[model samples]
Target: MSAVIDIEELRSQFLDQEFDSQEFVLKTENILTVARASGETRAEFSDESHPDFQAPPALLCSLASGRHLPIDFPAMGGIPMDGGKAVTRHAPVRPNQTLIGKTHLHDIYDKKGRSGRMILIVARMEVYDTDDNHLATADSRMVIREKPTS
Candidate 1:
């Protein structure tokens, strides 16, 4: 059993409020290491000396904020599960670039699942370079649902 979540209340209190922020200095060695580990075969991502050498898109996943949600999460009282993440790239991320990531509660909503009701929370993190150029946006989803009784 779980307490009912107040979607409207959560939205008003948390939406767009920054919860976590982090800074990362992209290094060629680290980027290449991640690329190779992820089995990326692209020369641009694996070869630092290549003219188009760039950080693999998957590298942004590692740059996510330390915390995904606000410290004071809503009192939904349900089993929370990771709903994965979606990343949208606006510009290429290059090595030696200093990037900042700021995360916030983007949205909260409910759905009627097969077993019961489920609440979905979305945390959006916007990434920018030292020059303030938008680089990417990562939306992490979390799902809350009631526990089944034996």
Candidate 2:
């Protein structure tokens, strides 16, 4: 197995890094239709009077926060492909709602691999409403494989 990764060190690289969190302000005109067969109800994603309603869950996770790029993978000695779990919050998102997403390194660990070593990078993604209230949080995991060069 490879050496464990230092999440603190990785997070420091993103410290003071500011990103525009305003891109989530989606216009009603931008709303897309969800197939009826998808079982999305009007009360769940849209209103009967207006077909152009936004889903809060979708808006919360709309964009990849800038912090995603800087995460370090100990096995690769650099950033790995962005991977995360899909999380949904119970709160309803309304149109013209603004959201901010922040990402931080959560943990890192290693496991033995058949060929060499495998490393896992875990990150926490938090989304907040305009009021700074936490809307949802997700634990994203990235896996890196370290194979010896022949």
Q: Which prediction has the highest lDDT against the true structure? A: 1
Model 1: per-residue Cα lDDT over 3-76, one tens digit each: 46668888899999998888888898899899989999889899888888887767786676357778887556
Global lDDT of each candidate: 0.82, 0.55
Q: What TM-score would every model get versus the actual structure?
A: 0.85, 0.59
- Error of model 2, residue 3, in angstroms: 9.2
**Compared with the true structure, what per-residue lDDT tens digits does model 2 show for residues 32-139?**
343243455665465534644455454445444344435342335544655555565745555577866676656666677676666566656666787888767655
| Model 1 stretches with alpha carbons more than 4 Å out | 147-150
Top candidate by TM-score: 1
lDDT of 1: 0.82
Error of 1 at 6 (Å): 1.4
| Residue 36 accuracy (lDDT) in model 1 | 87
